[model samples]
Target: MSRYPVKSETCHEAVDLADTLLPGNAGVTRAVVLVTDTAQLDLWRALLTGEARTSAVPVVLRRHDRRSLRGWAQRAEVFTTDERLERLHALTGGWPLLVDRAHRLHVELGDPDEVLRRLADMLADRSAVRAFLEATGVYADPALAAGYRSVAAEFGGDQVDTEAVVTAIACEIGDEGEARWVFACLDALQVFDREEAQLRLEPLLQQCMALGV
Candidate 1:
């Protein structure tokens, strides 16, 4: 069920609903999939601990990749040129929410460039960046998130050096573990793929940084 908080009362209800939805609880055993969207995820973090721990696991769904984005775009009737499609994929980085919005704009307006430009603006907004960062599970602490946002502002969607990010947060927040958790959460969110020692930020996240949130 959607919009149910992961609080004591709601969780109890979720347990019953879990039994109702998946009687035997086959694969996940006592899990309730509450569908909702928000930038504040402290409630989600709460479910990871205490008595409700086993009953709920906060799992953010993975975004699409280039191949999947292309397929999704085609299905959405975003019939643009291959070059434009590549640009769209680069800008959206296969984030489903972004691709969904971009494609609709693409269909409505004939100019592919205009659509992408507008989409980039949307992603670059402060509120959008804050929401995306929180949703990635990387910024649990407001102070730490703020520090990292400063570093992102410096980079402005350019190639981000992973070590620099870690060191910067460590310096600013003065907590090595919390600093490292940023990358750890990003990994869990599937936002970046590490090739060798290089950690490449996905395009969607890069745009968020460009927003300077």
Candidate 2:
């Protein structure tokens, strides 16, 4: 697994790069910070199966808890009612980035209702999200892109893609793999639902994509 490009690097090269990346390996710094999808992480571990694992610690950042989200609001001094906070929680699912963004907007607008409404609209705009992902070539492969569109239809309730996209994904690996394919691009497939103590898809993938993706 390399970077976004398909032919950029291989397992061996990445392993060799650990010398300059891991803590205290070079003059540049003691450690390296890498952000990648679950598939890349899996590939890295698989590459190390027969070798000793790196000493560098791995921290997985995920959605925040509802309670902690309140703390974020408190720190930002963005005062709002419980009902409004609940609405924000529903839109963001306690995703840290979204939560922070909401707090910032609340501070600017000084209207909880408007802040929450905008957040909802922002999440639901999949067309914009799709354009960004496509421009980045995040789903470059035709097959993979099709699979992504297929997953988007199911995950975000998006009805934009042609049926052919779904058919292509199903033909490649049937229903199950479509979701796994999505994980290849996203860091986490679901957000932690604090109330339920279970993982749930981030409310409607921004509504555009809870994908945080």
Candidate 3:
């Protein structure tokens, strides 16, 4: 297997590189392509056409400029900006990759507890959350962020505050479903007592029910 999944611009180049890197395999199913300029469209088109040969594996593309990949939003397996590549690799290449995407979203919660707390407090305050989400462009649609703020404001300072924080963060990050799951778990009051601290999760469940999650 290749040390890194192939990154190529042209179909022929990708195929040749894949064959050279993984001799026995006829082609590579998974790929990463970086499109920095519109001048590379011919190369991208060729790769897209050739990728049909191994459609089973996903071909994710990262665009350096939004204008360069505007037409490919629907075709690319996972569209992201070039600025996120390093973070993406760090998140997806390690043991964490073994977890499903939803689990990964939750796992991130443990990594940034302080940030989550701040976000939760902001969500509880409509004006603050709205300003924060709007300034950050958390959701593609500003209305979605507003909706999340509305949902979050319903239950503030409750035991589910932690879950609410996680939900608000996820919503801001465009992972609404994971946010709902976390909220649901909190509302259920499912406690997981550990040596460090007692974890309560009833607020999440209540929030989920209220949001029709």
> Best TM-score goes to which candidate?
1
lDDT (tens digit, per residue) of candidate 1 on 1-213 = 345435556645655466456654566555345664333333433443333444555676677866767777677657356887888877777776677777678668866789989877766577876876665555655654555465565554455567776776677778876666544444545656445666555656755655556
In model 3, which range of ten residues has the least summed lDDT?
Answer: 90-99
| lDDT, candidates in the order shown | 0.61, 0.52, 0.36
Q: How far is each candidate from the true structure, as Cα RMSD in Å?
A: 5.4, 7.8, 18.1
* Per-residue accuracy of model 3 over 26-54 as CA lDDT, tens digit each: 67365444323223333333443343344
Each prediction's total of clashing residue pairs, residues at least 3 apart in sequence or on different chains, is 0, 10, 14
Clashing pairs in 1: none
Q: Show where candidate 1 strays beyond 4 Å.
A: 1-31, 36-40, 46-58, 110-114, 120-141, 150-168, 180-198, 211-213
**Model 3 compared with the native: what TM-score?**
0.20
Worst 10 residues of 2 by lDDT: 191-200
Best by lDDT: 1
- Model 1: lowest-lDDT 10 consecutive positions: 36-45
Arrange candidates by lDDT, descending. 1, 2, 3
TM-score to native of every candidate shown: 0.60, 0.53, 0.20
